[model samples]
Target: SAEGEELLRKLPGYLAQPGVTALVFNFVDQLIHGRSEHAILHEVARDASALRSLTRTWFEESALMRALREAERRSVPVLLTTDHGSIHCNTPATVFAKRDATANLRYKFGEDLRAERPDTALLVDDLPSWGLPQMHLGVRLLLALSDHFFVYPTKLREYQGRYRGAFLHGGVTPEEMIVPVALLTPRSAG
Candidate 1:
């Protein structure tokens, strides 16, 4: 990571600047990679502990932590949040769609989208009621339900083998909906 360390070193300069500053750190890649590896090798359900441990380790060893300390030293109020959370998708649901459909496994929107197992998905034909813009006529939203991940029928076996236990988002599960928001103030500021 020495190659990438310099990029994060710039954080301090940004933090030192006057006016409201917003810092964003992306820990999703590591979480997803770790979870996918575990799912591929282990039969145990996607373990939250593994992700928690990974996050803790990343915070302790990464330059971001030093930046946090720097912010604290400067008495900079910190607000940390995530746009969305992820869920372990173990159920593979078959979906039929045209070649132009979106490829994301968690959700898809296209002129033609239908789940082979209707119970495993939620289909919304009324896009406007949901506040989603109607990109085109007859466009519908199909969301995988519970722990299900969508896989095209043409390559069901291939996709299932690769993404059966992967961590994915864009679903309606509690894990995907609920995220943490932390507001931290330095002791010196108080």
Candidate 2:
């Protein structure tokens, strides 16, 4: 807490000395980790509205916004983005993956990963089209569609229960693939 404040205090000096200074904020990431396997998992997990409320409240009151306000006061530019979008997963698609498979919930990257055609999608033969590099020869990406998530056949019930109703990404959907990018310039600057 105080450490972050100290960083902010030193920010202008850092900006003045160097060619470029980059300040990256991950407010939503902290909220995501707070909700899952980090903090009180049950609170937001049980009540869906808790996620929305927490997000809105944090955006309005968090120091990340305060830092941005300070930047705006100094007439600095603010650009906002998210690493990836997530969707509330419902359906489960059975896939076969090796032990060393890339263990993402919505996608699997491994050899011989298979799922039903209607249930999931398999992208092999090429990765450049998607801008994803294949890990190795014959390596492929198996992606879940719609609200579906990839679950290994082993311990199927356990994995399904663990991921059901959770927000996740790695596959394709309008919400997951499409992201909003905004460059914030204060009206005073204009």
Per-residue error for 40 in candidate 1, Å, reads 9.2
lDDT of 1: 0.80
* Candidate 1, residue 33: how far the Cα is off, in Å: 5.0
Q: Lowest lDDT 10-mer window, candidate 1? A: 37-46
Q: 1-190, model 2: which lDDT tens digit per residue? A: 6756887788667645635456766666566545545446646545457777777787687667777787688777777766677777778888886787888888877877778555566555477777876567777777778888887777789978777777777788877888888888877889
RMSD of 2: 2.5
lDDT of 1 at 133: 86
TM-scores for the candidates: 0.86, 0.85
Q: Kindly list the per-residue Cα lDDT of model 1 for residues 13-36, writing each as its tens digit.
A: 877788877665776555575555
Clashing pairs in 2: none
Candidate number with greatest TM-score: 1
